[model samples]
Target: MQGENTSVERGIFIVLEGTDRSGKTLQSHNIYEYLTAKGRKCVKINFPDRSTSLGKTLDGYLKKSIKLAPEVSHLLFTANRWELHDYIKTNLQNGVDVVCDRYSFSGIAYSSGAIKLDFEWCKSREEGLISPDVVIFLDVNLGLSSGRSGFGGEIYENIQDQSNVYKAYQKFTNYSFWHSVNASQDPNVSL
Candidate 1:
């Protein structure tokens, strides 16, 4: 078995996850830029994509425009990710990298922790999903993070909800792929 040769693709699926305004979008863009600079094929995508039907409904729910049962909303979030599964696989199989602003982790952390939904149930929703090659957790000082521009506007923008989401994210850090970055540092440094 020592000399066996196996062909493994080079495409990498990366996820940048954190609470609201934790620089995930910015970091995802930076990673995409780095990949492009190195001439690697890459695609950057965000969760609750807001373009698809399910995403549109999820957006409404997030914006407080529509109300859905906790369980229903959670499933919709999972559905949004599922819709992208094949697309993600296609890119990966083609040696194209995928950098995501959020993934199933957020679906579970935000949806369940921000509310009373069971964490186990929330985690279950993401079961059988494609695991990221890397998970960058942009951790930030809650007090400092809350003071950043544009706070307290969205449905789950409150400090309490953010705190809960932060805690929920900690649950999965035991995984070796998770990398935590302290975002409270200078922007140039964090990047």
Candidate 2:
């Protein structure tokens, strides 16, 4: 009878995506805390994670003091995620839900918008990567987004690129699994 008692828990992969200043970080943390309060095993992760070497490079590029080719910067962003691949898989296998601030979607949208690359071309770099079970995109107008605090530090932190990235996200919204939340509205109502 002991041998017959077997059960497995399925983990949920949730990704939060948005242009800079759209409050992706705040929402990701809010969800993580909410899940923890409910006693669910959960972990929060962010792309371009500054703790990793690749992420450090990304940080440098974002600050604009160090200039990298658009293609190279894009690759670095993708590599940062690749570095976390094993950890993500192991945690999910152990039945811990993973909440990510950004992922392949940000990689594709940001790079494509910056380099004028075709969506497929930018997406190819993330081929074979683990896809999220649920993708929540926070939508905000570029003008309002730029007016938000701390919007000026990053190299790609601008109204124009944010606009282009927002459009790129629209193309991806055709997928039934993708959910878009109006981030411009009140946070209590948006979630």
Candidate 3:
């Protein structure tokens, strides 16, 4: 749906990236509902999709059931995104908006936090992948996140790792297209 004087000329790719437990899942659903109620064609997708083979492997690793070298684990993370590359592109080509939860940003952020993985090295795996038209990073203090529900379901869910992820997330602030929304406030503050 387009406003009288506004337009979405084509498909819009909007991605939400944040440290673990930043309320992204909840916010993304709300955004999807708001857009749909306004009659916009949209679909929500999540990374490490967990439905594909690579995603399954990543899931196991995150669950701490599978072991991998830092480099290989991070590459699997990138490959998980690659698995959905064409699906995302096709949605955009068809004029359906994509509301994605996570992307290469998460891949590099989480992976590079490890001493063994280079930031640029993690990025190299995602070269040529589709870029989002907009990236909304939910910035929140790890201290604030510690109080949220479901905080420790995965391996990287702890405060120490989340703090490091926050540091990595900050690096993207230099990019004009990256929008950091302070998410420590009540979830409905802006809605």
Candidate 4:
């Protein structure tokens, strides 16, 4: 036991982000299942949780039933993640790896891409949060994604908006923690 540290290993934070219908939810679950099958503790979570009051507001906004300024809506999305910061941290500290379907990346990409918000400003709002260990950017063809079920149900589901968001997501591709995947392929394809 001489050089073996007796410390517990902290769990990693993995985020799956992409345009709507790009299989983020599916991939997140897949990662969680893979980890669990390997006997590692894992859990899946998603952004715009839609369970809290703020999330309710966000849900309304997404559904087009409530209107908010571009900046306000972006901040609301950030706040939804902020509200869950402690929970995520506690779980990681307890050795439960987290697979988040969408996180701050989606917020910044959507607001800046679709509404022309300042990318830096949108990114700054996410400062000080638990950074993801890796961000799996699901790069899929928007044309292909558009054909998926429930593709046009939300406000940003249109081609033009998704196109913008897709471009915005490209900005992060250069980051060291970012990983791009060809999501246009079958979901069963290994990542």
Candidate 5:
């Protein structure tokens, strides 16, 4: 017993990406539940983790309660992710699978897609972060999304901005670990 290895295997990092009303939050929860039901240790985390200071600022910007330049907002978003980098890594290393509602991809997508920032520049900020073992992009039709509830509640929820963001997400689809699913289906259906 003294020589037995006690270290547990690192957990998988899973991220869900998509436009507004694309059901990322719902699916992230579903995935977490599925893993837990299967007896896997899992934790679900959402980006811009609004409880944090940086996230609070990002929240104000999102809610139109405050204003920030495109570049400044972009930096803040990246910083928000950085704020939780250690937490994410620690959990993964402890063998707790992470199911994220959103991650850095949304940073690149929203900044570049909605604000016309350089795609490469937006992506550069995410270079040193923990990479996801799998990224699920919930693809939803913009028109269909418009009819969904709470479609325009936030700054980037508008059709034009979402269309741009969708386009940006397309650029990353070719990544081998990225998977796109049709989110237009009824919620009763399993992903």
Candidate 6:
């Protein structure tokens, strides 16, 4: 019998994480477009995708049309990512670099910032998810971030919540393979 070929191609998982209005979406798109223009096969995805069922739920919660418990909303956000987990893994295995805007880190940071749950508890829910190879965090002060366009519509879009989330992100810096970019300045200079 011939041996089966089971080698898996290792692909990079790049994640952009930050508070609302931190330019994560813009930077992620820029990187994605740059890589694609360079002829690299890449996949760009965003959390709270809003197309999936879980994401729709999160959208309702964010829009204040629905009132979910903090924990429930957090799980919904995590579930939104879970819905796309396989797609991400498959793309990576196919040698496509997966670039994500607002991923697991956001799930943990946003949830932990809002609720009193311990960091370990928030992390436990995401134990089996594929970890990102490189996490580029855009660090912007709450005041500046709030002043940006489209702030304070969602439940966690306030300066206080953002400040708490910033602290949580700071604690997350202890993890290996995480990079922090000071986004208080211009994106052209920061990235």
Which has the greatest TM-score? 5
Q: Report the Cα lDDT for residue 159, model 2.
A: 77
TM-score, structure 2 vs. true: 0.94
Q: What C-alpha lDDT, on a 0 to 100 scale, does residue 101 get in candidate 4? A: 90
Per-residue CA lDDT of candidate 5, range 114-176, in tens? 999999999997899999999999998899888888878789989999999999999998899
> For model 6, what is the C-alpha lDDT against the true structure?
0.86
Separate clash counts for every candidate? 0, 0, 0, 0, 0, 0
Instruction: Mark the 10 consecutive residues where model 6 has the least summed lDDT.
Output: 182-191
Candidate 6 local lDDT, residue 28:
94
Better of 2 and 3 by TM-score: 2
Give candidate 2's whole-model lDDT.
Answer: 0.86
Best to worst by lDDT, what's the order?
4, 5, 1, 6, 2, 3
Q: What clash pairs does model 3 have?
A: none
Tens-digit lDDT track for model 2 on 1-191?
67784665867899999999888898999999989999999999998899987787788888976788878887888888999998898888888999999999998998888567778877999987788899999998778888888998887787788888888878889877799988997544427
Off by over 4 Å in 5: none
Q: What is the lDDT of residue 31 in candidate 4?
A: 90
TM-score of candidate 1 relative to the true fold? 0.92
Q: Please give the range of 10 consecutive residues that has the lowest summed lDDT in model 4.
A: 182-191
The runs of at least 3 residues in candidate 1 whose Cα sits more than 4 Å from the true structure, single-residue gaps closed, are 1-8, 188-190
Instruction: Indicate which candidate wins on lDDT.
Output: 4
- Residue-wise C-alpha lDDT for candidate 1, range 1-191, written one tens digit per residue: 78886655769999999888787888899999999999999999999789999999988888899999989999999999999999998899888999999999999998877986999999988998899999999998888777877766678988999999999999998999999988987545536
Q: Comparing candidate 4 with candidate 6, which one achieves the higher TM-score?
A: 4
* Model 6 regions lying over 4 Å from their true place: 1-8, 188-190
Q: Candidate 3, which segments miss by more than 4 Å at Cα?
A: 1-8, 188-191
**Per-residue lDDT over 106-128 for candidate 3, one digit per residue giving the tens place of the 0 to 100 score:** 98999877433788887888899
Q: What's the TM-score of each model vs. the native?
A: 0.92, 0.94, 0.91, 0.95, 0.97, 0.92
lDDT (Cα atoms) of all candidates against the true structure: 0.89, 0.86, 0.85, 0.93, 0.92, 0.86
